[model samples]
Target: MSPIQDIQTEIDAHNDIFKNVDGNRSKMVKSLGSTDEASFLQQRLDDMNQRWGELKAKSANIRAHLEANAERWNRLLALLEELGRWLCLKDEELNKQMPIAGDLASLLQQQVHCAALQKELNEREQLVSSTLDQARLFLADQPIEGPEEPRRNLQPKTELTAEERAQRVAKAIRKQAAEVSEHWERLRANVVSWQEQLERVLDKLRELEGAMDRLELRLSEAQDVQTTWQPVGDLLIDSLQDHIDKTIALKEEIVPLKNEVRAMNELSGQLVPLDMQLSSITTRHLDDLNMRWKLLE
Candidate 1:
């Protein structure tokens, strides 16, 4: 029979048992009125009633446990649903707009954004972990299976199905937790890729900035040597040699500057479009440097 029907039948049986016993108790009291045995019989009946009440209370405790289990099932479903929606939304958003930065300022900002995104993912991961633990705890604490139960433990088949139901729910929750964790890993990979790309761009920009700054200083010093060429307190047979050595040293320094510029451009490899201003400035300075070098020659 169905659980509800079985429960109703049990209720009816209990009510009939109590009703007949109560009627018999009333008849006995009436029959033994004002007798010494009447008080002793009343005490015995009171003891029996207390024992029966204890039995009823045990049944009530079982029913209360069942109700609590049902509430836990609902809680697990709700948490899984909430976690699923957040995972899906974040996955879609991350895929749609990858991190891209055109300049160092924006690149630094993108790094911050990525860090914050990862922090959010970490929080979600913890929630998923706790939810999975809760599911496992529910499974551990859920009622035992009917088939494994002894004959004395028998109940309505439908009510005994609670064990199977709990197992299925836990299984489903486990599957969802796995999927959510996978989604989190995917999002984390994208963030890592984004951070790597940012590092590449930032490294290139800083390298170029350093190289260009050095080039500017060396070029200015060389220009001053060429434009303001006055021998410092010297009139000797080897005076011409000093000028030639000075020019040669300046030429050597400028060669590395050119090499630095070339290496940077090659590394950048047209993949990242740097600012036009930096390129234009480098080109202009190199042209002036070439003209200055020729005058020294």
Candidate 2:
């Protein structure tokens, strides 16, 4: 027989077994009519009917609980499906991106977009986590329905069954949650790394700018001193050593600035065109200063 037909047949058999309960009780009451034991037997029948009603109430409660559980499961599946789809889309978008690179203004704009994405990711991650928590709370409930004595006997088995079902769903949820979290972490790490890189580049650019400015200013000051320099014969006898030491001092300063120019030049190619131009200008300035110093020395 088909499963549905077999189930209907079983239900029909149960109905047949109980179909004569009311009639038998009535017939026995009539048979014992007017006897002192009649009242006692009637009372027993009434009590049995009350017990049956209570059982039916319990059955109704359990049915309602099962229906509610089904509804919750539906909602959980819908939410998980929605959350998973979003995570997948966002993950794909992030994967297609290369590292943030380019000029300062462009990198800064990318940094801003990365920050916004990071914030959105945090909010969505929390929503996913909250949905997972709600699913867990719903699954934590048992769906057993019956009298205490009978249900107590099967309580362990029922709990184990519920636990088994919950564990199965939990496994799926956990896997999805892990995948979602993995996506979030990967994206967040990318943003952080890109931001860090941008910061380093900007910092390097700033440092190079400062070094170039200092070198230029020192060269200007040295040129000024050169203009005031006196020839040995025109200087006092003791001022000879002092004038010679000025050239030595100037060389010492130029040596460090030359090294600074070289260092900045090496890094400029990897940075931006502006940095390369700045380095180039500084190199020409240093070359001019060195030539002037050589003639003076």
Candidate 3:
């Protein structure tokens, strides 16, 4: 059966015991009215004493159960709090790394843009080579031209042989190609460095995700334990309260009985030991109940 059902069964059993004890106490009080029946009175007193012992044992068991439950609850609470702190720390660490992840994303976008530009540059270089080839074919068809004099027109100009002009143009294109190559190399290196950084950041993020998953599992388990034990805790508290009330009522019941026994003892001079034993048992159980209350607190 369920835990709640088990607790209800225990309560019902205790209630039955309480009814029985109250019934026995009433019988003992009625027996006390016939003081002349010494044998019957002694038997009744012995039965009451036995009942008191049973009650004390039951109370002790209940108290022990309560104490153990309290300790377990306290430990569970501590575990839950510790898990909460760990989760908070993990969250803070993840937040701190978010900026780095964002920066890596930006770098990747720039790298993609740089790659597109590089592709365009390669296409332009191919077009330039094709133009140069066409120009060479056209020049070869014409006769070689000799060096010409400098022209003094709207713009000052230096005339040169075809070969010299071709050499200069080729040299400038080679220099431009070299500069583009160097820029591409530098850009490539930066991209590689950013890629390495991104990998490391991704690794850290994966580790954080794993840690968070484990913490979440632990947190969920703790929550389940808390949920499952809550009803048991409530039942224990109710039982404790009932015990306290019963103990108080029993003490009040015992007071009048003890007084009556004491009066009977003076008359019979034989009931002193039983009265003293009952007092000691009552006192011990009261002390135990008090200690249980302290533990509960």
Candidate 4:
């Protein structure tokens, strides 16, 4: 299946899941006939909460992917615009250098200007190609290398007679002119290729835009589902809070009672030692009195 179709299928499945959850929630709410029914409702709510969390995570991932695609598309579009502007400027410069009709010096000057323009164009093309390669690699999640050094054509020099030197100069000029013509032809071909590539990029941009729209719609629906579940979640939270408050109050009521019992135990321990001392003193007094009675007898 096509990618769009696959996305639609996934969306439909999610919608079905959402519908099932909603139906289960409604049924559970209506059937609150016993504690078990309430427990089941709570369980279902927990499950729905987990599902909603999963859906939110997935939605974030989709948004991130869309953002990355958008960045790539924008970069590609910017590159095309820059290239178009550069081409227009170069064309204007070339037009300004056009040779006047039937003027030899003007024609020669134009030829020289053409040669210079060809060299500049070659350098620009190389720079543009490198930039495009890097951009492509970036979008593909690949490593990008540094720009390569431009290649140079080297001509060997030789010691020769004046006639031979003149002949070599003439030959070199003809070769240079031919090279310039060939470079111009390549530039024209490259322009055509760029146009075609631009069209392809535009088509891809449209596809991405459509995908973004669908994702946004899905996100909105998911938000609505979340909103619907909010009240149930809030009710559960409030119930838990009430239980917690009751437990705290019970603890507070028991603490002072526990402290009073501990204090009474400590007082009882102090009384036991005093009672032992009193019994010893009474026994000693009785012994002394019996001794005194024996003396009297």
Candidate 5:
């Protein structure tokens, strides 16, 4: 069956269900009669009536949809038939065969399939969009009713006698006092919240300030160390003198009052030991000097 026919069939089935519900309600009501003992039966009847009403509404909506789809499909089919007839007339007049019939048939089938798919997609898109709109509205927490009536408008305002006016004034004063108290309470609450937030922000700022102070102190210490190390640059050439003397002493070993040199006796071997010690000390001093210079720079 066609899509439109299928929709119509479904509508018909829903309508049948609705009608059967009405019969069930009537039968239950008749069997139970009008008595408190029949309350359960009456309740069932009322539920069935409500269900039938809802089903009837659904059926009506489905019927409308089916009719619309049927009309559209019919119009499209009629147009396709007209086009087919036109193509046949054209082929007869041309008196030529260029596989136009097969091409036209294929194109027509594709167009029909596309139209069907598009219609289905549009219906699904509409349903989804509607559902999404409903969900958004539900989540938005919007008010369901109009604004409340003004407090003063709850009862009409009127003039009063002198004594009544005094009573009214007293009542007004009490009401104003209550309103002021409430307002002050709200203000105090807000102030407390703001104070808490301010305290947190102040604590964070203080922490940052403390960190900055520590960094400044370290920077000052580094500067002092740098100042202390500045003379090293002037003493760089003089520092090499100690290395040179050590080298020369290894070369001209005249005094032998220290200990016996029996293990190794080459000047080159003595030079290696002196050079290694000099290199290690020089490396430490140079690294320290470089670090201080970098800090100063």
Candidate 6:
């Protein structure tokens, strides 16, 4: 059964028990005629009335506990509904962003690869530049190597005709020119390729950076929502907790009262016979007073 129903059922049961106990006491009181018997019945009636009072108090307490629990339950249910709505909104927003997030991630991965390739190209370019610098330095130091032969130690040697020397020098110069032109063309091609790769890397890096910024903005927005809700959530929880605390306090108050009633019940049970004797003794004492007064007259 439901909680409320269960509580009501228990209350009904307690009420029935109290009614039966009271009814039985009433019947017993009607049957008694002797003063001592009447006195005992009166004491029983008083104990039964006290028990009724305790039952009434218990019923009130149970009702208060139920009402407070119901209130807290309602608050919890509302909080849960609010949370559900908030989560639904968040989920919808996240769903809307999913495709964009996927695209950005793919682009970022591609950019990473492109950046790596560009880095490699830059390294190659640096190597090529260093090689050219070494070549230039080698050429600059060429004349410094080897010593010139002394003219005094040289034998008279036959000199070639100027036209012949010019022809031979022209042929050698042409060959060197062809080699230098080929080397410079290859270097230019390498430089162009490196520049293209570097540009691609820089472009990809920029795209990745933009994607990162967007991601950070989205995260910030999510954090803002969380921060906003946290306090509201805490307040709701605190309010519910306060309700629970009040319910507990009510129970705490009721327990001592219940214990006092129980103690009174035990005392009543102990004193019943003594009260009956006092009633019987008083009845006989009055009879003796009546007889002595008649004799005295």
Q: Which stretches of candidate 3 lie over 4 Å from their true place?
A: 1-160, 231-233, 237-297
Error of 6 at 138 (Å): 89
Per residue, candidate 1 scores C-alpha lDDT tens digits across 1-297 of 324335545765788877688779978977899787888888888887887777667656655666568667878877877887887887776555444544456667767777777788887777777887776676566443233323245566635444345455655666676676676677778878766776766787666656556655766776776766556555376687777787787777667656655664564454346332334554565466456445544
Indicate the worst ten consecutive residues by lDDT in candidate 5: 257-266
Models 1 onward score TM values of 0.51, 0.50, 0.30, 0.33, 0.25, 0.29
Alpha carbon RMSD to native, model 6: 66.1
Give the better candidate number (2 or 6) by lDDT.
2
Tens digit per residue, CA lDDT, model 2, 1-297? 222223334545655444577559888888988897889989987987786666556545644554556546656767777777887776676554445443445556656766676687778877877886775565445332223223334555555433234334555555665565566567678767765765776666666556556655766776787788887679998898888898788777667656655665555555653322333454575466556545544
Q: Which segments of model 2 are wrong by more than 4 Å?
A: 1-17, 20-23, 28-41, 65-73, 100-106, 122-133, 142-253, 258-297
lDDT values of the candidates? 0.64, 0.61, 0.44, 0.48, 0.42, 0.45
Off by over 4 Å in 5: 1-163, 231-233, 238-297
Quick one: best lDDT, which candidate? 1
- lDDT score at residue 42, model 5, on the 0-100 scale: 77
Better of 2 and 5 by lDDT: 2
159-265 in candidate 5: lDDT tens per residue?
Answer: 43232332333333333334433443443354344334333433433343344344345445546544544353466776767656654654344223111121112
Off by over 4 Å in 1: 1-66, 96-99, 139-175, 216-253, 270-297
Span of ten consecutive residues with least summed lDDT in model 2 = 142-151
TM-score of predicted structure 6: 0.29
Give a tens-digit lDDT track for model 3, residues 7-71.
44465567766567556765665766857675676676678667656665665565455445544
Q: How accurate is candidate 2 locally (lDDT)?
A: 0.61
- Candidates arranged by TM-score, highest first: 1, 2, 4, 3, 6, 5
Candidate 3 lDDT for residue 283: 37
